[model samples]
Structures are given as C-alpha cells and as structure tokens.
Target: MSRPLDKAGWQAMADTLTARLETRAYIDDRFVDAAGGETFETINPATGEVLARVASCDQADAELAVAHARRAFDGGEWSRLAPTRRKRVLLRLAELMEAHRDELALLDTLDMGKPITSALGDMAGAIGAMRHQAESIDKLYGEVAPTGEEALALVLREPIGVVASIVPWNFPMMMTAWKIAPALAAGNSVILKPSEKSPLSALRLAALAQEAGLPRGVLQVLPGFGHTVGKALALSMDVDCLAFTGSTAVGKQLMQYAGQSNLKRVYLECGGKSPNLVFADCRNLAQVAHHAAEAIFHNQGEVCIAGSRLLVENSVREAFIEHLLAAAESMQPGDPLDPSSFMGAIVDATQHRRILDFIRQGQEEGGRLRAGGEALDGPGLFIQPTVFDGVTEDMTIGREEIFGPVLSVFGFDSEEQAIALANDSVYGLAAGVWSQDVDRIMRVSRRLQSGQVFVNNWAGGDQSVPFGGVKQSGNGRDKSHHSLAEYTELKSVWIALN
Candidate 1:
C-alpha cells in the first residue's frame, strides 16, 4: 500500500550502505589482489553502472590461495582447535556480520540488483545460519558403535580437507554462509569462488572472517570468471571437494570434472522448474493466486526453487489465471536501493537479454503473453515480470530454466495430469500445492517430486528446515542438522580389550 521510493529515499539507502565498501579484494586473509595488480569493476546493477573496482583473481591467485589453505589445514591451527573454541570464533563472526549487516546488504543490492530489503534479509539469514551451525557443532557427537562382547569400537567426524565452493549471484552472502558454516564447523579449510557478477559481499565476508580470528588460509576467496577460476577449482586434485549452486548445465560440467579429476566429492543445488499446483476446491482463489504470483516473481524470479511452472485444475484455471495476470502487472521494476521497490533490475545485461529472447521464443511457440511480456526501456537492465498462458509441456519456455521473472501456465483436468506435468521437467528442487482440502494436500504432497513442498501457502524457509532437491536439482542437502555431514568425513575405529 506504500508508494514506491522517491529519489531522496533511494539516495538515503545508497548513502547508508556504501560507507563500508572498500575497493579492494580480500585474498588469502588479506584485502589485496593478484601479483599482477589487476582489478575489475563492480557494477551497480540497478543502473548498469560501475560502483567500484575490485581485485580480480586469476590462476596464480588460486594457486596461492590453495597453498595457504593446505598449510593451514595441515598445521591444524583451525581444524585441530577445540570445538568450543571454534564455536567462539564462529559466534564472533556472526556478531561481526550483524554489525555490518546494513553495509553488506547494500553491497549485495548495488552489485546483484536485488532490492535492498531482500539484501538485508539475506544478511540476517546468513548470520542466523552461522549461529545455528555454531550451536550444532558442539551438539554433534561422534558415534559409539554397539560392540559385541570384549570389543571396543568408536566412530568420529573428521574435516574433509580443503573445499572449493562456487556460489551463484542470486543469493551471494546467504549461500556463502550455507557453505562455510558447516564446513568450518566440521574443521575443513575452505576456498570460495563467488560469481564475478556479485563478488563484493563475498570479499567483505572474507575480511570479517579474518577479523573474527579465523586463521589465514582457512577461509580464502577467489573472484574470477567461471571458465577460469571455476574450472580450476573443479579440476584441482588439491581441492578435496566442491560444493556448487548454479544452473544444471554448470553442475553437470562440474560433476564431469569431479569424475575425471580426483573423483573428489561434488555437492550441488542446481536449477529448478518448480510447480505450483492450484487445485479446484472451496477456498480463496484470489489469495492463492497472489501467493503463486509472489513465488515466481519474488527476487525477479531469480530463485532456484522459484515456482515458475503453474499447473491449475481446469475448473479454476480461468479465474485463477485472471488473478495471476493482474498481480503480475503490478510488479514494477526500478532502482534496487529504493526502500519501497518490490521489483529490482536484472543482475546483468546478458541475463536480461537472455530472458527477453526467451519471451520471444514463448510467443513463437504459440504461448499467449497474458501480461508482462517484455523488458522496459530503461537505463538499468530491467525486465518486467513476464507470464505465458496456454503453455504446453513440450515448449522450450516450459522446458528450459529462464532464471527470470517468467511463468508458464498449464491447465489440467485431473490431479494425475497435474502431477505428471509437474514431474515432466528435469528439475525437482521445489513445488507448491494450493488446496483447502486436507486430503488433497496430503495426497499431492506425498507424490510431488520435490525436496520441499508448501501446502496452502509458499512457506518461507528457516535454518531448521532441510532444503535441497532430487534429480538434476542437486545432491546433498543444506540448512538442517543433516547438512553437517556434507562438509565432513567419518572415520570408524575398532579395538579389542581383554
């Protein structure tokens, strides 16, 4: 109900957040650059303008970072530290993150083009994840095997050695914490590779980690192109494991490298074409439609588990879609730092152009553009939230992951048809069901092929919830206590005492 942010509000948001923006790269526990002293522009996506020049790491930079990590891990300065002591450092890092929340939040908005409110939410969420991991670290006890008579046996967790984690730009700081929290808790040293599109927050995170007393090399960052830095990490024998969050194509490529290279463990949370099933029932169609619109339109539909595929029962398809189209028209794009802006610019020009091409493809495939079909004329790379009605399962728009604020609508006559359409995609990251019937909710959820399901509303998640997907969406899990194992290795021992 509030009006969009005026010019003064936007300026205030920018002024508050950029005070902590240091135009240096955080590398190997220091805010410095490669030996060649190269730097790259960190752009403000809201305007397609440069915000600052950041350190650009290359292959040599990666080698230095890995060597530093190897020494830190071998010396056991951090890995060998007592769990309680490690907890203190992690807790302190969380505190630091909280203190610098506003700055980091603004940095993400400036660099990634997400709204400032969403950026701040990411900071708060990252700090919460760290605190949760710190609490969980000490609670986890190595197993005591139930031994036969006259036998002693024990099992314990060990750090998985050096990890090279690649994160996407959509949720920079939050995913970084998702990787580092459990990895550090289990005593593994880490080397991070943040997307070149949004590397500022990750660099700031490195500085904060060091200030919190994390040993040098224990947490280092590499910010470079995926073709170079990403492939290096994937193929490095020195790197023990790789955790990545990005497109399914990239995940497959990394898996191939993992298989070819040291057979290092690979964990990924890849793309999704999640389904939002709306069944005809005695409920509020308007409310359900609003929730569905928000699911796919939030963050300009950059979320991996975005409910972009909408399957509505034939009986309610017309009414539901009417409400959906109305909602989509209201999601306007503007400056990210605007306090009242619901929609922000796309992350970069390339992605913006890609989404536009997809929109053209939808029209060619006979899908009707009900609302929001094109990019507006603007200075920043901004795409209005798009919708394609009468979409078929075989259309390219339905099959491919657009990673934008685009939705595909499908009408189904039965529950079986809806489920079939939902499961047809190669992805299975998340799904949502909207029905007032408890029986319908229980039935559809049990058969839905997704890691997370929302019954009546799209549930905003929390740290305690285990989230990840089946199939090409990725392997392993994040968030809950189970994620701890992904960053750890277990060892079993047996001794006979007479």
Candidate 2:
C-alpha cells in the first residue's frame, strides 16, 4: 500500500521544519564550544542553501570528549549500572526520541537535504532499534565452561573501556543508535562522532539522553570534522574500541590507526558495489525491476547496500531493462520538504557533483545510459535515477561504488558466469537474488561473497544478524549479539589452589 501524503500531515511537517538547528558539541551532557574557534557550513543540498554554522571541532574538542568518556567508563557509574537500570534508561531515551522525532527528523532533512520521508524512516528505525536493544538488554550473560575434573571455567562478558562510534552522513540518526544502543546495553560508555555533514541530530540526541537520566558523560556526541574529532577518537589511547561506517578509504585509515595507537577493536561498515542477480527462471521481471529501481533510488542510492550492479541473464535482459527504465522515468525529484516527493536531493553539493562526475565518466567509457545520465537543472542537487546497460566489468562505474541512483547492468549466459561476475568486485557487502527456484537461491547465497544476501527481497537483516562485510568492505559486525561483543572484553580468571 502506498503511504498517504495527506495535507494535514504535510502541513504539520512544514510548520515544524527549520533550515538550521541550535546545538553544540556535547560534553558531560552539556553543550560547549570547541576549544578551536572554528566553524563550517552545513548546507541544504535540496536548495544549495546554508542550513547552519556548525562548530569545527578540532583536536582539543576531541580530547575533551574522549576524556569525558574515559572518566564515565572508568568511574563505573554507567558500566556498573545494573542491566535492568540500563534498560530503564534506554526505554526512557526511546520515548524521548519518539516525542521529538518530528523535530529531529525535520532538522535532519533541512541540514542534510534528505527528504522528510527518508528522515522519518531514519527516526523510526532509530527508535525501533533502541526498543529492540531495550528488550534484549536483560539477555546479556557470561558463559560457564564444562569442567573435566579439577574445576570450572567461567567466561565473563565484561564491558570494554570508552568506545568511539563514528557515523556516516547517510542515515546518521539510525546508524548512531545502532552503535550506541548495543554498546551501551553491553555496559560501556560511548563517545559519538557524527559526520559533520549531518551532526545536528546527534547533538540533539545527546541532550535527550541527558534528560533520560543517563549519568554525565555516559553518552557524548562530538560534532566535528573527520580530520579532528573523528581522528582523535580513532587514535585516542583511552578509547578501548572504535566503530565506523563510511568509505573504504576511511575504514582503512581506522584500521591503521587502531594498529598504531592502542590496537583497539575497530568495527567498520564500509562501502559496496553489490549485485542484484536476476536469473532467467524469474517469472515477474517487472516486479523485480521495480524493486531494483527502488533499491538504488531510495536515499538517492546513498545506501551502503544499494544493489548497484544488476546481473541479468541474457535471455530476459532486454525485457528487464525495458521495465527498469520505465521505473526510473516514473520517479519525481521534487522538493525534499514535500511529503509526496520520492527521490530527494543528494546529501551535499560535493556528493551531488561526485555522482554527476561518475555519470559523465560512465558515458565517456562507452557504457550505455538507458535512463538518466545528468543532474536536473534547479536550485537542488537532484539527479535522475540512472541506469547503464552494456557496462563492462573494467569500467569505473561498474566496479567502484558510485553511491548514487545509478545502476550498471551486465548480462550473463550461464550460472557459473553470473557468480563469477558478481564476485569480481573488491567489495563483498551485500547482494540480492531474484529467482523462483529454491535451488538457485541456495546455490547463489552460498557462493556470493557478501556479508548479507537477500533472497526474493531486498531486506537482509534482523537485530541479531552480524552486519559487516569481508575483504575491502571493512570488518567487524554491527547488529546481532555479535555486535555487542565488539564493545566488550573477555577476561580470563583462574584460581590457584595448592
């Protein structure tokens, strides 16, 4: 069913919306200035307008946040809080988020220029994930090993020290909650560094967290650039673990920083050039095509798991391509504030131009554009949902992640060839299978070298499933019980009896 775009609902959002949010870097549950008196422009890509003058947090602000987090974790006020108490605090935070969701989501759209619809989903997903963690917080436990004769071995699940969670611009609020909820539930104090492009929600959340009765410094948000606050979090000796979601290049730098600084646990959810494989055995090619368009078109294809590369069998290639183009043509890139808008603006002008550069390069490299290949003329940074046919494997558009509403189509003759083509990319983040045959689903899921594989649908996760990729896609899991372990340490206790 289509979501209702009612006038009342639209009017409510319009009245609440603002181009800028009043916030500051959160330290010890209080808003403060960056020691460095610097600032940056947070722009609205939907209209290329400056939304807010955000603090340019430098090394000093980073140090302050880390110190506060270290104090909170080491003080044991938060880390030693009983699981039920932690759960109560989490539940309270969830309620607060719901209460202010419209405000938070609207501020996010204004700053990042994501559609209000997308922002609402971000807010809902963040609240849902927090509730999920609240319910499961009590399930945490340590395991007792079986004894042969002498004694028993107890494996205690203990909270690690201060944690640094760095989120990307896309889905900032949801990603922030994804890391914080599990890490906090596992009994660790956290320092959050949201992307400067969209840090308003993170700061706003920090205030709500304080109101939720979370002890001072239990959760801190540092609104700053990657070179300063982000780098400090990654390189701080006091930070026991670091979590990040961004490009592979930054992920690699985090890996190196972890090794160089404290050898801290680095959890990363990086980029992708995932395959959405369409076998000839599929009956509904049109439905499959429409869903594929949705996969890339959603969030302007800023999703880490966008099915960017479409692998179609040669037999039904032409018909599927026709349907895919039709789906793209139907999409409208209107104002992000409008509730009726589907495709929204790119997150920022840099990203807008980056996606456009890739499109132009795709054309120059002989890839055929069946749909869109240019940015629409207007005040907003809007690009039409794009599709390229006859894309060679070597082309930059096919191999590298464009991270926009762009899809590369390559036809395959046999099952072996399809698998080979899908696995050819350096990234193994996510993939989808569209086939009626169960055997094909089983075969492809096993052979596909991705962290998550979606069969007959686009969704591929629950809160329990580990959500990290292999190879260049970055390491460590985000969701599931496994994710909680990333922010914890296991201490071995042995008794000496003589």
Candidate 3:
C-alpha cells in the first residue's frame, strides 16, 4: 500500500490489522502456542488498549526453540549452504519485508507507540541492513596466512551455531534485523526473543523468512517476559552465542548467566547516558539547538543512544536555551498513527511512571525546569518534552540513563570542564560535539569516552560503520562486518607441503 495520506487512512489500516494480528510463537517453520498454553496481553501504549494476547513463552519454549535451532545448525541444511545461496535467501527476505513495509511499520507503531513516520524509517533501515548483510555474505574473504616454503596455512571464519537475539521494545524491527540479519547471513540458526511489549512485527517477520526459502528450524520467534524466555536463552547450553540490546542491568545479568552456563559467547549493546556538547565556537547555534531537541525528544526519547545530557559553553548558554525551548515546543507528543506527530506515547505505563519519577527527582535535586516537566492530558501515556537546566554532573538525572524525553542541560566554563562533565557517567554509548573549530572538535572527540562521536551533528551514522559503546554501555559492535564477526569463529589450519 502507498503511504497513508492522513490520520484517518492510517487508523483505518491499523483497525484492519488489529482484527487479525498474529499472536503465537513461531518455531520450526510454524506458529504454535506456548508450552503451558499461557498468554499475555500486549497493550497499545497510545490508547491503553490490548492489541493481542500473545503466547507467553517460558523456559520450555526456549528449550524447544533452541533444540530446533541446534538441530538445524548441525544438520548442514543452512549452516553448510554456499555463501551465495545464503545471500539469495537473505536478499529474498529483504524483498519480502519491503513488500510489506506498511504492515510492519503499523505493527511496530501499534505495539510500541512510536510514530508511524519514525516506524517507516525504521523499516527502511531494517531492510537496508538486511540487504547490506546479504550482499556481504559472498564478499567476505577468508585469509591465507604466510608460512615457510615447506608449509601452508589458512584461516577461516565459521558460523557460531544457534544465536539467540534478545531485542528491546523500542525500534523493535530495526533492532531485530541488526542482530538476526548478520547472524543468519553468517549461516547460524537464530532463536529470536523479541521483547514481549513489541513482538508482533518479529512474529510476522518469521513467517516471511520461511516464505523466503529459509530452512525449517532455522529461524524462530519466542515472545515472553525477560525473566523466562530471556533467562533461558542466556543460560542454554545449546545456544552457542547470545546477542542483546537493552538495559545495562539486564546486560550484566546475561553476562553472569553466560558464566553460569556452558560459557557461550555474549555480545551486548546496552544503555547510554550520551552527552551532547555545544561549544561557543559553533557556527550555527540555531541548528545545534534544533538537533539538540531532536536528539532527546525523537521517538519519545526511547533511543538507546539518545543525547540525554547537553553540555554548553557558558558564553552562549542562555541564547542556546531560547532556541532549544522553541524546538521542544514543536515536538509535543501526539497520536502515534498520525503522520505529523514527531513524538509519540511512552512505551507503556511503567515507563511513563519511571520518566515522571525521574522528572520529580530532578526538581528535588535543585535542577531548574526550563521547559515542560509534566504529563500531557490524554488517555495515552504521554509526557511533554522536558528540559532541566542548571544540571550538575552530580545530579541523578544527569548521571543516569533516563531513557525518556528528558534533556539535562549543564554549563561549562572551559573545554576541559565540558570534557570532564561528559565523561563523568558510568554509561558512554554515544556523544556529540558541536564546534566549527577543527582542532577543538578533534581534541574533544578523541578525549570523550564513547563508541560513536558526532561532530557538528547529532546521532549521524550508517550501517557501513560500527554501532556500539564502551564502559557500561556494553561491549561488542552491531550493524557492520564487525557484527558478523561476533556470530563467527576463527579457525586456523596448517598444511605440510612436500
């Protein structure tokens, strides 16, 4: 279908989808009920309506899915397929996803409360990532190591079997693609445990994968609470590797579970308290302020690499705040299905309450509320774009990952102080530097402890480069050839020549 022209058009399409939503776990090339036949309600955060009662999978389901995945991996049906053959499968899957772009976008919007427009962008990103990884399958070359004249050596990259990808509710389709695309392209059987809050798109994607010529038992989708399905995947001896994108606390738990289990490899892309610095030397304060608001308010601030902290040089602090407040005014939360709505509802009531609590804590801790710090009057879980000025490095809102549409503004007298404030947090997933001075941008960008740094920009990068973080933001990269390495093992071979 073409892009919906108006809110009514989108809502009508969403109503059509609601009547026949997929609600079962997809395993072994089919949809089935949970082992215990239990179910859980997935709420539409925008209107507080139950979209579906999806299969509430648990440890038993995880075990079943893993067993299927292991069987498929060892059977040489997909794992031993030629790289070009795997490439064709992935390319076909991408085509299928493109064909159903509107449905997938609506599913994520209805499930997780992201704006329809943003969800469409996510579909494009997901499809692009799939195609990129597919094309890379045959292009990635193994190495022929140098040796003496009497000997020959070869190094090969082999797929790690049975990858479990546990993704977050925010940006569900894109995050799922980031993990499963690379793993599947690397010839691994994948058991995907999408967050229960947003599993419709993933469950639907599994069927498309099967239709795209993926072998039976090669791809499975199990949706449930983290304590059950997630824990099981992390602790499963049959699972060769686990890749996750979520909170730091959960990432640490998975690490501990890895140690307690069969020592499977774990790759995490977790939480962030990213800092955005605006030096006075920046040529365009107005543009910087607009992007600064977008960095935190877009997607209702559910981004893992959201620039939650804004550090400004004292010289232009007041001027920047004026432009930033104006930008925030244009980003008020609205119905997610509305194409004009840039910001949508919070993911759920629990997250809504957590964001409110942090806002309250920010006031209690003496940070001045410069702009909206209250919830919008609506049936949905929506909050105004909140900005806290006078934030110090010691403030709770400044140090912690709020993961909401909240921006903490801090002022620094010197470049040294700005760098110090930016690096003062336990999380360092991403950061932004705004400066026209080439030397200063170079200096600050190198000194900041972050996985990705955007200079004169905010949150700008593509799948060609790696996406990940250091410190508590979690280790391991995603979305590039580096991500493919995570799902593969290196094998070195030496041959004697007569």
State the TM-score for model 1. 0.96
Best by TM-score: 3
Residues 126-151 of candidate 1 have per-residue lDDT tens digits of: 99999999888888889889988888
- For model 1, the local distance difference test gives 0.86
On residues 1-498, what C-alpha lDDT tens digit does candidate 3 reach at each position? Answer: 454558999999998989998899998999999999999999999999999999999999999999999999999999999999999999999999999999999999999999999999999999999999999888888899989999899999999999999999999999999999999999999999999899999999998998999999999999999999999999999999999999999999999999999999999999999999999999888888999999999999999999999999999999999999999999999999999999999999999999999999999999999999999887899999999999988889998888899999999999999999999988889999999899998899999999999988887888899999999999989988989878889999999999
Q: Is candidate 1 or candidate 3 better by lDDT?
A: 3
Please rank every candidate by lDDT, starting with the best: 3, 1, 2
lDDT, model 2, position 218: 88
Model number with the top lDDT: 3
Number of clashes found in candidate 2? 1
Q: Which consecutive 10 residues in model 2 have the weakest lDDT in total?
A: 11-20
Which model, 2 or 3, shows the larger lDDT? Answer: 3
Q: Candidate 1 regions off by >4 Å?
A: 1-10, 13-20
TM-score of each: 0.96, 0.96, 0.99
